[model samples]
Target chain A: MNVEFINPFLTSLLNVMSTMASMELEPGKPALKTDPIAKGDVSGLIGMVGPQTKGSLSITFERELILTTMQKMLGEEHEEIDDEVTDLVGEITNMVTGGAKNILSDKGYEFEMATPMVVTGKDHTISHKAKGKKIIMPFSSEFGTAFIEICFEH
Target chain B: MNVEFINPFLTSLLNVMSTMASMELEPGKPALKTDPIAKGDVSGLIGMVGPQTKGSLSITFERELILTTMQKMLGEEHEEIDDEVTDLVGEITNMVTGGAKNILSDKGYEFEMATPMVVTGKDHTISHKAKGKKIIMPFSSEFGTAFIEICFEH
Candidate 1:
């Protein structure tokens, strides 16, 4: 994976969490994802198609982090996953992907993004559309960990 | 839900299974999907973006059907979740969606399709991208059931 292609998404994820949910995320390391099972309880996934390249981006959130972030962003504490939680996660996924899409567009990688899908369940599965090594970037915060998986073929 | 928009997919699914894998599918009554938990062991999901409406289509197959279909299609059998199964499921997802896409395109609904994503696990979860009621069109075959989830915002 090229840093030029991937750095924008990492920066975008950090920025989205900070600005939207007031959650600061410290990125740990980038690794190749060998397993298809999700790392967290809930995930939002979006696919991207460009003139030359196409791929997918997904962000998985721990249960505690998702619930706690909901309290901060919506000012309401929710006990379980509902339309509200799914909506918030969907927005977060859209914002992160949209932010990176802009930078990539400016760099001449014009692309179109699909609507994001949100899934909530213990040990849920997510598989990217792109064919290649999918990279998992882990981030730590006060709540727990956020995993961003990116796959792009070049 | 408009039958005009969804009938193509149902017909295409039956045709795809019958022609591609020599499996005949009997579609059951269409109903709204209230549960996010997947109905089977493996699923393939694809998203669509169009001029007016956008949504997703997913095809899930039971383990026996997947294995049996693989045996018929590839002349191989005996497997847990593996690359071959996922690839075949992905191709089925693509073909079924593509078949309907062509019919829908002829009907004047131009759509750009995202590449399909394959997920395999016991009791997995699947969430569609579009808003509004998600419809599950179930089909029965010799092996087991195959569920087709369709959601499009109108």
Candidate 2:
């Protein structure tokens, strides 16, 4: 994937976490996705297509970390994956992706984004039809670890 | 949901099942989706975006039926949810949605489709960010029952 396409999403994720939950996230090494099972118990996925690129972006969070983030963002306690928790994750995904879209748009990478979809389970796999290597970026915070994946075909 | 947009999918589904697996499917009534838990153990989802429409189409199947269909489609005995089985479902989804797209395109609805995504689990939920009613079309075959869900924003 192009660095020009990757940076907007990375920047947006860091900004979203800092602004929404007041947490600082440290991004680790980026790698290609070879595992079939998703790294987290919950994931928010959005598909994007542009005049020059097409692919998907996913934010996956471990159960405990997501719950902790939710507790802080909602200013309440959440012990379970209720509707509110799921919605919060979805909203976060939308905001982060939205921020990325804005940045990419200014760079002349005109793209249309699909609605974010939330998939919940312990052992579930996501496979997109696009033929390309997917890039997975690992992030860690005080709450727990999460992954941001970007795959685009240009 | 407009009949103009729904019939093509139904027709394409029946055609795919009959042609690919030699199974005849009878579609039931279409209803609005309210339950968050997906109806089947395995599901094939494709997102569709057009000049005037934006939404998704999904075909979810019971495990047993998917297994049986794989057995017949591949002319072999398979008893597990292996990668091949998942790939078969993804292909079926792509074919069915491709058929529908062709019909819709002929009728002047130009749309771009994303690669199909498959989710497998005993009990799972799929939530889309698009704010609109989702139409669920239930179907029954000799093997088992399945669902075709369509949700779009005009």
Candidate 3:
């Protein structure tokens, strides 16, 4: 596994989130949360593949956190989160991937990205076909908490 | 605008296509010869947003090209392109964004990427919304041709 592939992306994401959104993410011991946050929850995901391995990365957040994040991003208060808010989250994933891509290019990795798809509703789980490894990096902010999961197989 | 944000991604995609398969891409030009090939058409897309801009990246290819590429990646020739082939294309986009993200991180741009959606069809057009700038880089291969379109407002 190319651990170098993951480090730059993780660092870039931390810098973007902290500096641009004024949000703080403390890296916790690797673990997946046990409790469900309820259904109709929206989460952002990005997937990656290279000459050696392939996998997906996802950032899951609670509904309230997403709403508040949007509020801050748009610079206005909101009483309710709608389709526009969903679109906002999808775009957020795009920016994170964009930031990570830049770092990966310097390391000599080349690939293309797909348009984002917004998943809604509850009772859904994301499954990866990779049989090699999966790493989950959990994080939290003043607005809310989220997790980044990286799964890949060579 | 940030042409840097878009150029490397296009280049990386060209590299992936050329390296993974025997497809020859004529950069900056559309396909000169149309070949009738049997394969599914798959498209993957991701969106991006920030304090300064918002946009999306879309990559589309013929089904045969996707299957041949995956066969080359895995070093096995598959009789058909199934879920695995689609997943491979999605992962390719994931890799592309991962590379792009690193570059944008240095520029102080923060972003997140959404889950990839695979749309299958014979012939279709994918569109995005951007009020400011739009760029399209088209490449051709023996199996087929695909293009990357970046549209955003800064």
- Alpha-carbon RMSD of each model: 2.2, 2.2, 11.3
Give one digit per residue, the lDDT tens place, for model 1 in A25-91.
8998898887775568878877776767777788999888999989988898998877788888888
Candidate 1 ranges with C-alpha deviation above 4 Å: A34-38, B34-38
lDDT value, residue B88 of candidate 3: 76
Candidate 1 structure lDDT: 0.82
Q: lDDT per residue, candidate 2, B1-154, as tens digits?
A: 5888888998999999889888888989888787565557777776666778777777888888889899878887778777778778879888998999999999998777766667776666676656677777878977888888777777
The whole-model lDDT of each prediction reads: 0.82, 0.79, 0.59
Q: Estimated TM-score per prediction?
A: 0.90, 0.90, 0.48
Which 10 successive residues of model 2 chain B have the least lDDT summed?
B121-130
What is the C-alpha lDDT profile of model 3 across B4-45, one tens digit per residue? 777667777876666666555677642211221212266666
Candidate 3 lDDT by residue in tens digits, A29-92: 5543232222225656555545554555656666677777776667656555455765676677
Model 2, A17-116: lDDT tens per residue?
8888888899998877765555577778777767787777778888888898887787878887777777887798889888999998998888777666
Candidate 1: Cα lDDT at B108: 88
Ranking of all predicted structures according to DockQ, beginning with the best and ending with the worst:
2, 1, 3
Better of 2 and 3 by DockQ: 2
Residue pairs with backbone overlap in model 1: none
Candidate that scores best on lDDT: 1
